[model samples]
Target: MAKDFSDGIKLSQPRPYLTRMMLFLALVGFLLLILAPRIMDAFLANPGLNGLIVGTLFIGMLYAFRQVLQLGPEVKWVNAFRRADPGLALPPAPQLLAPMATMLGNRKGRMTLSAGSMRAMLDSIGSRLDEQREISRYMIGLLIFLGLLGTFWGLLITVSSVGDTLQSLNVEATDSASVFTSLREGLQAPLRGMGTAFSSSLFGLTGSLILGFLDLQAGQAQNRFYNELEEWLSTVTNVIDVPATAGENTTPEQASLLALAGQIAALTEQLHAEQRLVRELAENQAAIRPALEELAGSLKKRGS
Candidate 1:
């Protein structure tokens, strides 16, 4: 189970800069949204077309910003997971590969390549697995937030516009043109507000649903990879415990007990040789599983 979890973690790691860039864009989008109303009021004096454009931009930016924020945390989580597994080794850049090959070839090139490839594979897998969880969670939360924000903004506009229309109607017989103008303005607010609310919510919900499905797929992949890793690791560990043959005269029971004892002894020696490797692996697995489970739960809840 531990090995399986580790493999899942490996496969989930975030992309090099994709996550970061998304996060940055999201943040900028959010900031623009925060100042959207003021900016619209000041720069866009034309309330009809300009107001619609500003509202659209604001809602779009808010949706995008929320998504980015969610992604940032996910990337951080993946990076942390990668750091926990000491056994995993990230691959060197292509430029470094040539020098590494030259140096390794001087001694045991094949052995070096084998070890390096194994390590690199583990690292890459772990990183990607970690990232998958992060992206999944971000998308879910982002969609929900975007939907709520749009709804709230829409309501505000609707209420405000309705109040203005009522107030204008209550006024003494004023200029017919001015009264009609006020009524039109009031009507426009609710109409525009409704459009923003429904459209943004629809987009946000759709995005969330799509991403949620992808997250599930990623989780399944992670689980499969983890199972394979566990099987391989178990085989390797067991190989280290293979016992030497005893004399033919030895009883089957005696041979079995001896083998068991030998295996135990080998495990102890292996643990000692690797210093804290066993303990670290155990600790890393412990830390990762709970977090992964938590993330899975969170994703499920969000999807629901």
Candidate 2:
């Protein structure tokens, strides 16, 4: 039985960036399990600040993962289009690759493969990538900021308590036992203050380190996706598309797409015009051959 391409090629499964993310997270979890006792003690020492840092770190990780996930559709869109059969419907393209869906041209009510001058396309992709990464970058900065805030806050508490303890101490007391008892009670407050300082610092710094690594993973994924798109564009040649007419009921998105297609069509015309000019110049040179030969003959006879 022969299968018809009336239906477009089946799209390949989207590649995932979660594998490395999951593996790295698992490793962190294992390490945390081993240090559970120490971590529990620190959390107890300053529950308020430590809990905040941990919560923010979790949110940032989720955001980073989502950014990487969004990149998957773009790669999938490009790959499917590259392999798609002409006049057959393939899966829908992501927003970033929407230009390709139109730029390829819709012929006889079906898609046809066409690619040319990837610079504009690449630039568009890069700008979208920048927009997506912006939030993740801000989250990273926020994590670091929170860590620093906790450190200074804890230090302030320690400093204030130590100053109060010093002021309350008596140099000379009528009864030595009473003086020692009062001194011990005041010293306890300073010790607890020191605990708050060290515990908050520990959790804040650890949370930042973990989030930083996840951010690095996200960056590498984006770079790889961009490079793949660039390489695919290199091997393609141009096709001049006829921009579709927009109807009164057309949505803003569709209108924008039509405009982009029109721009590309204009550029293609310019390229073809330049090609025609070069061909004309070559033909003119060919036409002058006989005249050039006669001129040379006349000059030779005169010289002789």
Candidate 3:
């Protein structure tokens, strides 16, 4: 059933900007992962940590690319729905929005599409829209955590080396030259450890920034698609009060509908006028009440 509808309805190509942005992010991420090791000697020494950071970045980038692909079908669905006839018809709807069309089909009474039904349709699509956002958020957090983890791991190495060197130094057995050599070797280890710490931090921060931007762009695109869909649905889909019957006298029914509509409109105007009069009376009540009370007292006194 899904295949049949998909074959019938034309799908638009992915937006160029989205495609280009994904490509740009992929290329840059690839370059960074490749060059980081050669450019920074520390990465070469700690290949495992650097690899993990780069790997995490690639995962985030791929997820963003997948989100862009999902949005393409949505764009096509919105465009088709916008161009479809306002009356009840098999409008071009995406798989995600197929429930809406189905809901309309199941209607049997004089009930038109109500605001509640519209809300339900939008809520159905909202889940799909939120999926990418949720994934992006997780990726962004994970990338940052990995970076921080690397930084702390490098710091731990530095601390451990310092402790080992201090424990190895002997005061009684080593001469001045020997002690000096021990100190020099100990200091060198810490410097190397510091380099690893800084290298991991640098890569981690860069990865997080890239993922953040991609996530932001994806969110914007999703929002735009949703707004367009909502506007189109609002304008094209209507709340049909009267249900059209098959092979029956529609003339009397239509005339009755028109009469009912006219009556409702007249009643609405009448209600508004009555409400205005009530408001005016309420506003003047404070001033008028005292005068009316005074007149009543005067009339009583005159009677007495």
Give the number of the best model, judged by TM-score: 2
Candidate 2 error regions (>4 Å): 1-17, 99-102, 105-117, 238-304
lDDT, candidate 1, 161-268, per-residue tens: 787778767457668887777777779877777766665565456556545544554455455544544343342221222354566557789989889999999999
TM-score of each: 0.38, 0.66, 0.62
**Candidate number achieving the greatest lDDT relative to the actual structure:** 2
The TM-score of predicted model 3 comes to 0.62
Give the better candidate number (1 or 3) by lDDT.
Answer: 3
lDDT ranking of the models: 2, 3, 1
- For candidate 2, lDDT tens digit of each residue in 187-215? 77767766777777777677778777877
Cα lDDT for residue 103, model 1? Answer: 36
Question: Model 1 — TM-score against the truth?
Answer: 0.38
Q: What lDDT does model 2 reach?
A: 0.73
Summarize candidate 3's per-residue lDDT along 1-304 as a digit string, tens digits. 0111112333345586486676877788689689865646856646788788879888987788777777786676555643444454644566666776667554433324455676788888888779758988887888778778877888988999899888988867648999988888888887777877887887788888888888877777777667765654554345555665643537877878878989999999999999999999998998799999999999999999
lDDT of 1 at 53: 38
lDDT for 146 in candidate 2 is 72
What RMSD value applies to candidate 1?
26.2
